[model samples]
Target: MLNGGMKWMFLILGTMIGAGYASGRELWQFFGHESVLAIALFTVMFSICCYVIMKISYETQSSHYLPILERLVGKKLTGLYDLLIILYLFTTTIVMFAGGGATMEVLHFPYWIGIGVLAILVVVLFFWDINGMLSMNAIILPLLIILLLAVLLLFIKSNVNAMLFDWMKQSNWPAAFTFTALNILPLVAVLSAVGHQIKHKGEILIASIGSGVILGGLSFLYNQSLIQVAHDLLVYEIPLFAILKSYPYYMVLIMSFLLWTAIYTTAVSGVFGLTARFRDMVNLPLWIIALIIVTVMIPFTTFGFSTLVAFLYPLYGVLNLYILASILIFPVLKRYDLLS
Candidate 1:
């Protein structure tokens, strides 16, 4: 049970700590100075949301996000939200592909070659179906988490004098809601597909709480490190490189690898959600569905990494607020329904 829970936790982390988050762009976008309170609020809200979504998924034994979406927002709105989720998964996965291409370009690889490689890898990943993704996350996320935290901790240690604690000026607290909302769709899409695999409620608890704590901690540390390099942010497309500036060249190369892996994991999660949603309809192998999806998404990667993230992320964040609210209120409503 412990191992199972950890697997799900890693899956959630893999889905989240993608190109944007790992590159420090997403954290800086939603959180920065005066965000200590915001990060804490995000931690609680994120855990509650994850627990509610996983509970619904497990109960329904969902094969895709549609069932869980219906439970969260009722049948009438499920179709609309389903489209929204499909779009979210599609666009974000493109961002990941673009991010992969950009990362490789930094290492002197051709951009198209990088995108093609990532696309091929994503399709190949689904050959084993869901287990491929779960297994990959289980192996990759731990190392990514450790390296990211290590870099952030080292940065914090060196820059302790620059750290500020101004809890009284936490106007950015509202960002907690939007940022958490931004992630609800993918969480639903991915977690719902694994419902039948979930053996017990204990796994959900571990996944929800564990992912929340790890992500929350990473957000705090990453945001702090980004804050120290706020001025240098404009000079680099990837803000994480700004943080890595003082480090050795080898560290930059290592982090570039980390960033690419993060991109691959999220891209895999996105493809998983999309392919799972269409598995029954297409009547084809999962890899074929993923192949077709990636084929369609490749051209969009030309939009570039940061551009796609900047334009789409905040837009989805705002649009997903209703879903976020519904998930947060689900437990209360479930109890009320039982009483009635």
Candidate 2:
């Protein structure tokens, strides 16, 4: 049970800490500059939301997000939200691919090359199916957490005094809600597809708490690190690289690879959401559908990574708040049999 929960826990992390979060763009967009309260609230709210969504999905033993989404929004609004979920996944996955281009562009690789590499990788992964994604998440997420924390801790060590002033500001608390909202669609898209795989309520509980604590800790540290170098953000498209700038060349190389991997994982998750949604209708293998979908998206990556994140991330965040609210309030409603 412990091991099983850990796998799901990592999946949650892999889903959340992808291209935008891993790259620091998504976190910065929502919870930055005196966001201590925001992060705290997000951690609690996010954990509760995760447990609620997973429990709903697991109980339903759902293979798609439609049932879980319908429960939250009801039949009246389900079709509308379903369309939104698909569009959200498509746009966000494009962001990830754009992010891949941005990541590679930092290392002097051409933008299209980076985008191509990630698209190829994701399409290839679909050949192995969801198990491939699960296995990859298990392997990559641990290193992602470790390496990300290491960089964050190192930044904190060099500027312990900076965090003192940083933690005192709390005006950004409200941003937590929107941030959580921005992440809601993908969480619903990914976890809802795995409902039947969840073995027990304990697994949901463990995965929810573990991912929340882990992401919260990392987000806090990473946020602090970014605050220290916030001034340079204007010049760097990927703000995480600002923290990595002072490191040795080899460390920089390693982190870049990890960052790319972060982009890859998120891209794969986004594609999973899309492919899973249309798998039945396509009348083709999931991989072939993924390949076609990804190919069509590649042209859009030219819009640039930071540009897409700056515009789309917050817009979607605002849009997803209603759904986020539903997820948060679900347990209370369920107790009264309101949803059934």
Candidate 3:
């Protein structure tokens, strides 16, 4: 049970840690000084929501998110949220594509080439399907987490002399709700689709708690490191680069590759959710649907990675609050027999 739970946990982690979270861009956007309580609230809230959503999915043996969506918000709001979920997956995936292009731009490569490479890889892998994608994330995600932590920790160590500023304003605690909402939609799509395989409730417990703790810890540390270099943030598109001020050019190159991988995993994961949702309806191969989605999304990548993230993410976060609230309140409603 523990072993199975860890695998599912990795899947959850891979889905969550993508380019936005790994690049320090997402954290800086939602979290900063005086966010301790906010991050803590988000961690607990996130873990609970994951458990509720997974348990609902597991019990229902959902093949896709629609059935789970009905359970989450009932039949009345299901269609509304379903459309939102599809749109959420599509746009977030595009942001990941833009992220890859932006990462390559850091290496002086043309942005289009970077987007092209990631798009081809995503479509090709879909022909093989989700198994290979999850397997690859299982291997790569641990290393990504370690390297990212190592980089952030190193920065924190070397920058001890740097002065802190007005980073602890307490008003940011509420962003935790929106941030958690932003992530919860894609999570539902992915986790729900795997419900049939999860046999034990214990696995859900472990996966939920384990992923939340790991992500929350990383968010706090990464946010701290970014705060130290907040002044340099205006110039660098990817906030992860701010930590590399003292590193050799080679190390920067390595980090950039890691960032691109983060971007790729996320793009694939988003497309995976999108494909899972549409596969039954389209009378088309999953790969083709994915190709169509990616093709339609490619032109939007020119808006640039950071720009899309900056503009779209917060909007989605706000838009998702109702869905998030529904998920959070689900178990209570179910327990009281009020949801029917």
lDDT of 1 by residue, 62-172 (tens): 888888888889899999999999999999999999999999988889999899999999999889999999999999999999998998889999999446778789989
How accurate locally, in lDDT, is each candidate?
A: 0.92, 0.88, 0.87
lDDT of 3 by residue, 1-340 (tens): 9987887888888888887888888998998777777888999999998899899989999878999998878899899999999999998999999889888999999999999999999998888777878787888888888988898778878878432434456677898999999998999999998898898999999999999999998887888788888899999889999888679999899899889888888888899999989898899988899899999999988788788889988999999898889988998888899988
Q: Predict model 3's lDDT versus the native.
A: 0.87
Better of 1 and 2 by lDDT: 1
Q: What is candidate 1's CA lDDT for residue 171?
A: 89
What is the Å distance of residue 251 in model 2 from its true position? Answer: 1.7
Worst 10 residues of 1 by lDDT: 331-340
Considering summed lDDT, which 10 consecutive residues are worst modelled in model 2?
160-169
Q: Candidates 1 and 3: which is better by lDDT?
A: 1
Candidate whose lDDT is highest: 1
**lDDT of model 2 at residue 222?**
87
Question: Over the stretch 1-340, how does candidate 2's per-residue lDDT look in tens digits?
Answer: 7887898898888788878898898888887788988988899998998898899889999888999998898898899999999999899899999888888887899988888889889999998989999999999989988998888888899988547744565888899999989999999999999999999899998999999999888888888788888899888898988887888878877888989888888889889988889997879998999998998888888788889999999999999999999998888888898876
Model 1 TM: 0.98
